[model samples]
Target: MPPIDTSIKEHLNALLDRGKGAGAAKAPAASPVSTALQRDGASVDFENVIAEMLGAIQDMETQLSSVLEINTLLETDLNQAKERIRELRQEREKLLSTIARLEEEMPSKRELQMVIDQLIEERSDAEITIRDLRRRDEQVGAVLKGLQDAQRALEDSRAQLQSELAAVEVRLEAALKDCGKLETRNRALEEKNAANAAAIKELEADLRMALDERFRLSIELDETRRALAAMQGR
Candidate 1:
């Protein structure tokens, strides 16, 4: 198998950290994540995070590829082993056929009996060879089974890992959506505040004008009372 890339794990962990405030524990899956992570002008590095996850998946696929290679080699060895066993069994069949034919045709021939004895000895040797072949075939079968088991385990791991990555992606998307909504709300609030400030400035100007008019009226009244006092003195 290709060496494990710990960087992929590290990247995944980083993305998980970014999603932590997405309130995985608090927020439902379909709901938007926490808007707290969103800065005014800053955005989440979603593309980068997803790219790293894809890289991790690629690494897992590479490991599975190695498992497949092992399975292929084992399958080849198994086929060869079975073929050798078949050849041995065929040799034994041919030997038995020869012996049967000889016995039927020449049972009364003296020299033919000697020939039958030699053929029987050869048949025993053939039987031993076939037995050895069968034993080797069993060993190959066991090895193939072990390789198949390993392949299954790798497949399961890949599937689980992919599922987890999918979850992370969902959370990230939720967080992004939350960020967008927050930024919009914040903008609206800022606009409202600016409008309120302008209204306050107009109110303050009106108040100042009212106060100036009152002061002018008091001054005019004082002047009129002085004129009435001067006319009475005359």
Candidate 2:
């Protein structure tokens, strides 16, 4: 690209020299329109120089716009790079935190072995207990069956005893009725015996009076016979 300052300076110096030359030379002054229309060499040179300066300015403006566009692109790239670096740093910190946490949480080999051994021992003990309990449960089931059979036997015996007791109670009730009848009969016999005793006493007293009367009669008859024999002898 051409330099803007140099081009402008050269054009201005040429213009100034033309003005000085025109002023120094004694020439008839022409009207502005005539001189412009004449298209003189100096006028034509000045117009061409102005046209070149304007073209140079336009070229400079285009180059300046391109430089600005490139600068803007570079700034965008730099900002993007800075943001990516920041994200990477954050990711690094997170990874370091994760590593530290894992290190703290991880168990030692000895501790893991101890836990495995304890689990094995517990499993063995549980198996032994399960076998013992199963055997005991079988024995208990057998005993329960025996108890149930004995209870059934006891129930049958109780039913038989109740039947026998019912029979004995019936016999006892009949015996009680017979005893009641005997007591009544015995009371009647006692009353009859009492009446017979009173009659016997009265008959004994009558027999004694009859015997006394007979004795008196016999004595009287003997006395009468003795008197009669004495009279005859006389």
Candidate 3:
């Protein structure tokens, strides 16, 4: 019975060794984890590893979602900036056009101002001339009035001289009548004293000549005075 028991134990040991050699001879499996589980009777910690991998995948998906959201925000901001730039460009163009128009109009505006200033100066000159003309008219009117007064004075003097001449002519006529009456008396004495009668006739003729000369001189003087007055008026 002891030999039989020993033989059975040796056979079991040999079979176990043969199994290990066969496993070693075969190309090693790709994974040692599979051999370790079979030899060690260790259960695969699949639950904990799978949970850690799932957690990592979940964290990666969360990070991707955050990246996508950030890219979307940046795109929105870029589009907004583009629109703002476009508006700014448009405003700049409008301002430049306004400046160009103002520049073009500036010279014409200056010319218009110059023309207005010239017109103002011309109007001022015309006003000054008008004022001067009015003053000259006033002076001319004053001179005309003075001339009219002098003419009136000359007329008065001529009238007075004419009246005096008429009175003198009447006195000469009366003296001539008295001398004619004396001539008859002298004729009667002519036979008695011819020399004395001739002397009386001579004296009467001289007095008549003197009166005629006085009248002629008075007429010449009046004419000369009127000519002088007209020259002064001119």
lDDT of each: 0.52, 0.52, 0.50
C-alpha lDDT of candidate 2 relative to the true structure:
0.52
Off by over 4 Å in 3: 1-50, 107-113, 128-234
Expressed as tens digits, the lDDT of each residue in 149-229 for candidate 2 is 655665565565556555555655554555555455545544544444444444334433433543464455346445645
- The TM-score, computed over Cα atoms with residue i paired to residue i, of candidate 2 is 0.32
Model 1 over residues 1-234: C-alpha lDDT tens digits?
333356744654565566575545674322111232233322344435454545545554554555455556555655655555555455555555654554454334365456556545555555558876566556555655665565566556556655655655565565555555545554554555455445444544443454465457547645755776687699
Residue ranges of candidate 1 with Cα displaced over 4 Å:
1-128, 221-234
Worst 10 residues of 2 by lDDT: 41-50
Q: What TM-score would you give candidate 3 relative to the actual structure? A: 0.31
Scored by lDDT, model 1 comes in at 0.52
Q: Highest TM-score: give the candidate number.
A: 1
Residue 222's lDDT in candidate 2: 46
Candidate 3 lDDT at 226 equals: 71
